[model samples]
Target: MSKSQQHDHSPLHIFLIFLRMGLTSFGGPIAHLAYFRAEFVDGRKWLSERSYADLMALCQFLPGPASSQVGIALGLSRGGYAGALAAWAGFTLPSALVLILFARGLSSLGESVSAGALQGLKVVAVAVVAQAVWSMARTLCPDAPRITLMLLTTAGALLLPGMWTQIGLIAIAGVIGARLLTPVQAINHAPLNVPITRRTGVLWLMLFFTLLVGLPILTHLLPWTTLALVDAFYRAGSLVFGGGHVVLPLLQAEVVPTGWVDNQVFVAGYGAAQAMPGPLFTFAAFLGASLQGHPSGFIGGLICLLAIFAPAFLLVFGALPFWSAVQGNRRMQAALSGINACVAGLLLAALYQPVWTSAIFGLKDVALALLAFTALMYWKLSPWLVVVASAFIGWLVL
Candidate 1:
């Protein structure tokens, strides 16, 4: 069928299509991208391969979760603004809800079972993040220059150990990339059919920045916990450069220091999130629901979930109209290359700090993490299965 003839332009149809994928898609961001390609580009003939690649590139260039942004862009292409939202909701809500429930039920578990399971989750997180670092290093830090950038970023982050430090490193890396690095080969793709006008795009971009800057100021002035929650989550969502995994360090810095969520709980939720089948950004929902104080339960989860994802919504809509103009710019690509390498380094730092130190207590934990990593990297076992097995082992043996 022709593209137009096969396409279902209704927002509801878009939601339903993504909802199914939300429930079934696993592996992680890269795997999610593959699933999107199969279902949208090939199975449904929603768009051509080139268009899909174009959308993926645009999403990669932006800050928020790339897979979710790509889904939003795909929805926008077919169903307009509402479709974009529908796509995000469909792809995000299943996991968000599941994580929220996990957060709520965690407290009710038997003490020993909870401790064991949580430790298992934490151990698996170490394996998952280690795998991410290994995989991203292979892809993002391919050459000596980028490898140096990655190593330097890791060192700086480990030494400085704060959110601002990570952001500063990313900015510096971008500048270095633009000045020192050459752009990689580019693939030409068809123009995206974004329905948003430049004028609308500008307004969306403005809102994105407005929230980024204003939320912190508002939280500081008002002393509202909810607003603070929004600010922290929003900034994490906005500043994230690489992918969902990169958000780990940002979020730990945000919630852990403030005493909003315990460090152990944070790492445990992150591990549990790995078992869920959707954008890892739903990890925000888990954090929100697990908040220590007011607005915590379902409301907290909803607020944090929306706050973190708001930037993704705004950026994809805002950047779409302008993407065609800048897509071919070598300098822009170079800067992004540096930023990605730094992000990988940031994740490496995170793996050591909260994911590793918090989880690995002894030889048993080390064995479990190594086993999980081997399962992921060599055996190619499904991540969810590894997570489950790890949790069971923790309960039984740890």
Candidate 2:
């Protein structure tokens, strides 16, 4: 087949590729994107370069986490619904398990250094997110109208930091974009060609979600430690947006506020998560470990882990067969438009106040961030390196 005509969108293959991504992908979103390009574009030739770029743009245009969304998009291109689940599981599992492991080690550490490390980690998170905005803007926000929406959303988010408010703006932006920009004809529209008949489609979707919902319940009912693990992961997986960092507060809300974990321990685990290379949801691991003294012990850890990751899995699977349908639907598209615009706003708001102000603690942090940005944008060093260097620099200066 011609390079443009290379059309192997196999579900099993996608699962395997993402399994590799789960195992190896790290360095946050930029690093994850680079890994994705390596796997899908250079290694497999699954998508033409232009098509891959277009797909990346589309993912950025949506809500939720960009890397996760991109991974799902890739799987959808490969094997329709099944491919999406495989991709999510593959990319998420390694990091999730790693975080859990890290959590076990964290409980014994003192609170002070852990808190400092976490604060630094937040800087890394903010910087990386800003990097995403810059990269996406260069491509996704190119047009006059889109740029307008991007800036506008940023302004709105600055004034209002609430998640839903930010989400609303993206939906509006999508509407304006659809009206203004031409429909981006995807190069590989293979997954959109799902042959799921109506009855089969409904049946499959129902069964898929049922399994997703039932698995956690069944796991919960079990007296095994696995039940708690499953529960924790499921909750975290199900709701986190903008990747694992966003779940910081969610974990706090679910566990801390409920007295599942205390403040000192919570802060310490959050810090260690920053020191790690995997996803932020790894905080769940820390939470699980700390729960050792609780009634559930291992079960609690297991539950936290499972609850944390379940949402993402559920969303990915539920939307698998509906990828094309969601992409094409007017109302869903409208809501997504607002959500995307809100995400942009959220990023912008994040860029200014907490992300920038908190990190730019006087001249030193600013210097580090500028240096980091330069290394990323101009020197083109790997993002993980930037993060590590930034942490060391921060530690040294501190």
Which prediction has the highest lDDT against the true structure?
Answer: 1
Number of clashes recorded per candidate: 0, 48
lDDT of 1: 0.80
For 1-398, candidate 2 gives per-residue lDDT tens digits of 56433335556666676776665443455446655664566457676543454454444543346677678767755676677767776776665555556555634543445444444554555556566556545544445655677788878877776556644565566666556555434345333334445555566547646755777778757755555445545655554545666767766776666566788878877766654544556567568767635544445555665566545444444444555566566555443443444344455566776557766666656666677778766786655566666666666664
Please name the candidate that would achieve the greatest TM-score relative to the true structure. 2
Model 1 clash pairs are none
What TM-score would every model get versus the actual structure? 0.64, 0.66
Off-target runs (Cα >4 Å) in candidate 2 are 1-127, 184-267, 292-303, 325-346
lDDT of 1 by residue, 1-398 (tens): 57654457878888998888787665567557655765665457677554565566567667888889999999888888888999999999998998898889764432334567667877877787787677667766779998999999999998998656866887898799899998655344346678988999999999999999998889989999999999999999999876788899999998999999999999888877876778999999999999999889899999999999999999988999887666557787787677778877876787888668878999999999999899878887656567778888988888
Model 1: weakest 10-residue lDDT segment is 106-115
Task: Please report the TM-score between candidate 1 and the true structure.
Answer: 0.64
- In candidate 1, how many Å is residue 131 off? 20
RMSD in angstroms between candidate 1 and the native structure over all alpha carbons:
7.0
